[model samples]
Target chain A: MRNELDQQLASAASEAQAAAQTLDGSAVAPSRNEPDTAHPSASVSPQAPAEERPRHRCVELGRAVVITSGKGGVGKTTVTANLGTALADAGKRVVVVDADVGLRNLDVVMGLENRIRKHSLDVIEGHASLDEALVRDRVRKMLALLPAAQNRDKDEIAPEAMRALVAELQERFDFVLIDCPAGIEQGFRNAVAGAQEAIIVTTPEVSAVRDADRVAGLLSGAIAPKLILNRIRPQLVKRGSMLNVDDVLDILRLELIGVVPDDKDVIVATNRGAPVVDIAGSETGAAFRRIAARMLGEALPIPALSDRSPWFARMFASLPFGKRSSTRGS
Target chain B: MMDANVFVVTSGKGGVGKTTTTANIGAALAKLGKQVVLVDADIGLRNLDLVLGLEKRIVYDVVDVIEGRCQPRQALIKDKRIAGLYLLPAAQTKEKESVSESQMEHMTHALAGQFDAVLIDCPAGIEHGFRNAIAGASQAVVVTMPEVAAIRDADRILGMLGSRRARVLINRIRPEMVKSGDMLSVDDVREILGREILGIVPDDEEIIDATNRGQPVVLDGARRLGAVYSTIGRRLLGEDIPYVELPNDGLWLQLRKMMAGLR
Candidate 1:
């Protein structure tokens, strides 16, 4: 019975959501700032003027970026944090929203836990204004955050609200990146709420790649997502212990974002309450910077996550140079 | 009293009788002289107490203990009728957001050290709630109904659990429907999920009525439902219970629904 019930519900939910097309901020999302007194999950915060509903109004105030994974623990959050930080560092106002509700680790990873006295739930319920809900990062004129609710089911937050919130954030921020949760469920729904494009974060493992393939299927009806291969161990790839970048790309078939090589600095920075991007001069930090630039339509091809300088590549590079000297000596 | 042995009752999809399975399995295990704690990890929608007919007795919920609003012992709602069966009810007031993954890990770690079996009613989504329910769990029982959507979700969740390394249990099959080919067979579901099936709970109407009265179906000693739940509990205790055959109910219901819709 539940099997029948879930099948019916899943198809209906997806269809209903699809038929509605895109839920626009001004049209569909009732400026939730209105005084709502009924549902506690409704609105308890003060009202915002109609003008405050959609925050930014620049020419391209509508870019939506969703960070996703086909597999878990591939550092999707790390990419969202670092890449979003890099974008903001370049002076574009950014807001990173964690759509992984109930299991919210984004705040700690972003070092914004202390700043998250207010979260996205507060904004949705009207307990707090959007401005109050946004936790600002120090990336200067750049980044803000809408933390996931630690105490609620993300499914309870309608996709309608997600669209409205995204449109609203787009009006205010130069870029809005949704840090999607692992597993395609209500969390994924809430994460992809209003975003148009997605960036899939995957690793060299088969399981991770398989999961990304599933995510790409879901994303096909919308925008084709980009790929960021995280935690690439160059030595392992060199030793043929892991799948290389091209191997993963071949399976996923999505556009490639910058590849983030596996580095202990990522974990080190996560521990220090700053993303790898915050640590200037780190290799991952630079990669993230290039990725951010690419999102903004730059012509830079950030190298795939590889250290071909290992035996094969280094030997290959040395062959040309060594051959020139050997020929002269001979 | 909590004991060393424990297993969580969970499923990939929502409303696939997770709370129903948790309530009955917990009650059955406790009936067998083992101390049990039924912790509803469907935090915001805590209904294990309701399903077990202990709702009126719940004074504190899981969040109270986790948030330190009350002592861990205080938040535990004990059911003396079942001897060692107790329930750590989910806090209806606290949203899922407030409970951190780290906190849930610590909570389950402590429970595993104390309980014989910690039956966690995992929520519908594979968000934080599912992960929280699986933390510190030695084994998992993934309950799924014989339907395509549930099976699909179950397969996806099985893959996820595979990544995290958790066992699964298939649940709630109407033998007649499956036999009539109106629903997926146990074999079909098993093939898709590809996880160990702990039990195949028959479509027991006794469960609905029992739940209506806030009692577990297994508490009724006469019915086959009790045996089914007990068989699952015994299986959890490492007993190999043979799978029972569900009689084929010809596809009358499906034909009727289609005709009704056409009319």
Candidate 2:
């Protein structure tokens, strides 16, 4: 009975694989033609001179950014989900890829885990197509997720394969945000392989800062990464108990892209399997929106913790060392 | 004679007190009359010598011994304060790739034959450096803080340790925070990592001062942290000592209990 069951399961898997391959073969071929009519830039390709091909291709490709932290649970996935949702809310097509492999959480955090039909490993292993692997977000039409295989190890998908997948995704989406696994290992290298830019996420702690410094040094040769300081408690900073934004900047020496204050709402939203940006009246959601705007090259005033404090506290905040200027653009 | 045990002190995330733990535990073990040798496996960032207050006496390092430039005995620095405590310093100028796994394994085995315990200070991250550090050890001690990030990395490291005689050393735990549910409790960490508890070291500012002064906390004798490390040493020696309990954070603890009761 066991042998018969195993045989049936194997045959069913093979049948599904064959069906997926057929679907993928058609899906991959027609996407290019489908985009030609939808995108005006593609129409310019036939009319453009041969000399402008390289420049046109560069304009057509989207930016690929990897969010990473050498320390785990410093909110790399949370930042990726919020940033992707915020970008999608701004009407930009976005795809967030979970590159953490065995410890996949981006899909759950994005509230699209149950909808996963195909995973990144399936696409890389030729069992599924990119379209089959990409799960469109239920609430947000502009956002999609390329979920990682939960059961697969980090070595299942090589860096070269991830690069190819990211390159293909870059041609279709406006922003490709890859959520990197913690630690500078095979998974981290794979996450950063195809990305043009990097965002280092860290919390206001000595351990996180040191790991971020190490990660920054490793990523220095490949991409000049921007730093996102997450989980900052203003009250603790004021008490001089925690490392402030400037202290972190002094250690990391990277462009400060965003500062996300610690809020209970973030944990609540994460527990509910929704990005904090989807929660109404979330301060962290507003922070993520500001980060997205800053990424788009918008010059907005940095939100101040003192603005939410009492009037008496604002007077003490005016001290030179207490106040921080808005992070200037790179 | 019983076989000498080897333990590798590692935490996947940096700055979680791996080197400090190694130094203090070595000193504590030596204080307990066990011959101990602490190996610094963080080649590029040599900190074990500095933590042991033997930085200036380092004429030879682990790489020098591994490359046959000097005898392992010559590279080992004896601590004058703690009898039978020695440190095999790492080469600051050399990268992690300078030392191979086989060389480290052979060196550790040779040292284990002479000492009662060999503690290898593994570098942060699960890279080549980490692999080289753990290759020699028969046991592993994963140091982590009470924060979610450190616990997550500890879980990953524990997963990598995989069937090795590994114990979780919860370091820098702020009891007040844990009591108030602001920080992860020992129960929470135990549940997540599912490892046997070695000990919990309280978050103490004196540890930083002790590190800066090149004095291991175990040498202080008077500090609570010194007692904590000594207790950890006793536990490693197969003694059953209960963890140190901190004073409650008063009304916050009551409020949290009431909140739990409501739930």
Candidate 3:
């Protein structure tokens, strides 16, 4: 079983490497245990690495800090959902503030949408107070969710008011994650108004990283945006097709936080309205859990995406077929 | 915003259903009694003919017509199913650079009056081949998938289209993927691209088999995506074609599933 697992892990690594090669333009030697490297692009080369490990996940243990990416579908909600679950699992009171005004997806992702009656929109519009919108995740004892209203667009909310609401949430929770909408317009500006520290979620593709780079450029004079590369495909990197996780980090040039592999189970669980972390033994779910552990001042290293499900890509890596033509990987 | 005779099918990235889009849409237009021409512009990797499965019948390609080797009549490969629709095949042996800017200009100009709409299959890059494809085209149809890389490239392409005064076309979206937030739907791509979305083609297998056999899938009517392309072609002709936006989550999808009982 252990040998089978090892081969499976290697399989997953090569697939990730191929995906990475498409974007990163280099071959990543798979670390024996998937390297626990946050971003494959941040891995620098086979030799130089990104940061040694994640900085402390909990700043004061009691004060809540929500890190969000302003762009939608670039992995903001994933970061919020994962980080909130991670913090709560780590014994911190984490509340994810889904500030996506009209699009209430956080509760749907966290599997709490069915229970949401009064969301953050009603509270902000004076229909209800902030406390009334907080919906506790039935699975995570210490974690809570503040749903957004489904009826209004982003223009209805104010940044200062959203910030004030976040401040109040901070007094009660250890961490508050605000999932932002896509675009650098009103929605993004509003989501960032209150956070003490910001964590930007980006994929390895040039566009997502480019947007993250723009966000990082905006963040340079202010608080540094911590980087989290979600939905990185390692196999594509090996084959020189998709951008590597490290290439993204290099462009944005932000401190690397966590790397999440592209897992089919993520969709499977999310469609069932479950955050992946609840699956327990799934590779991506474990990665999210490790991310939570590291956030709580735990010493666990951020695992490289190559380690999870090594069985997926072993055959492709060993193929001597691609070494000759395609002048791409040099 | 173009006159009825010119429709250009484009995608920001290569291989995201642009050629397939051209085949289906042109076939759709041809079926509607309008004189249509599908021009292959990807100079080196010319597969539009192969994808259309009209490779064998070609006597002279676009190079022959532009380089003055043969008259446009001898080079035009007429499809049997659609009486008015014709295809101008590109040269497989030559690179994108083989055709000069003026040659591409004169080619589309010459064809403008001959057909009601000239559908140019634009090549897949930010280079010369792309320029040649758009040289004579009046309207643009930007085809794209709902994935991140496709969306990103589509945005850059949209910026280019906006500068050139062209409309956009979206293609090959999976409704289930959108509902689960795994992939963006037509709405997401349209919002991000910020261009008028011409049509949305659902991920369907018949289109693949059609591409395999080189026949236009629009004639098949077995798949809804092909029918959607036909409707898109009508919309390109300014016929006010109506297609309900396939929602990220909806009841038709549920009913479609109950009937097919897809796994």
Show model 1 residue runs off by greater than 4 Å. Answer: A1-59, A304-330, B1-263
User: Each prediction's TM-score against the native?
Assistant: 0.48, 0.69, 0.50
Compare candidates 2 and 3 on DockQ and give the better one.
2
Ranked by lDDT, top first: 2, 1, 3
Best by lDDT: 2
Evaluation by DockQ, superior candidate among 1 and 2: 2
After superposition, which runs of candidate 3 have C-alpha atoms over 4 Å from their true positions? A1-67, A304-330, B1-263
Cα deviation in Å at residue B198, candidate 1? 24
Per-residue C-alpha lDDT of model 1 across residues A65-116, encoded as one tens digit per residue:
9998734456877788887776655444567888876556667778888778
Top candidate on DockQ is: 2
Over A76-132, each residue of candidate 2 has an lDDT whose tens digit, in order, gives: 888999999877665456789999786677887777878999999999998988777
Per-candidate iRMSD: 21.0, 7.5, 13.9
Alpha-carbon lDDT, every model = 0.65, 0.74, 0.63
Residues B52-76, candidate 1, lDDT per residue (tens digit)?
7676677888887888888878888
Task: Give me the TM-scores for chain A across all models, comma-separated.
Answer: 0.74, 0.77, 0.71
**TM-score for chain A, prediction 3:** 0.71
- Cα miss at A248, model 3 (Å)? 1.8
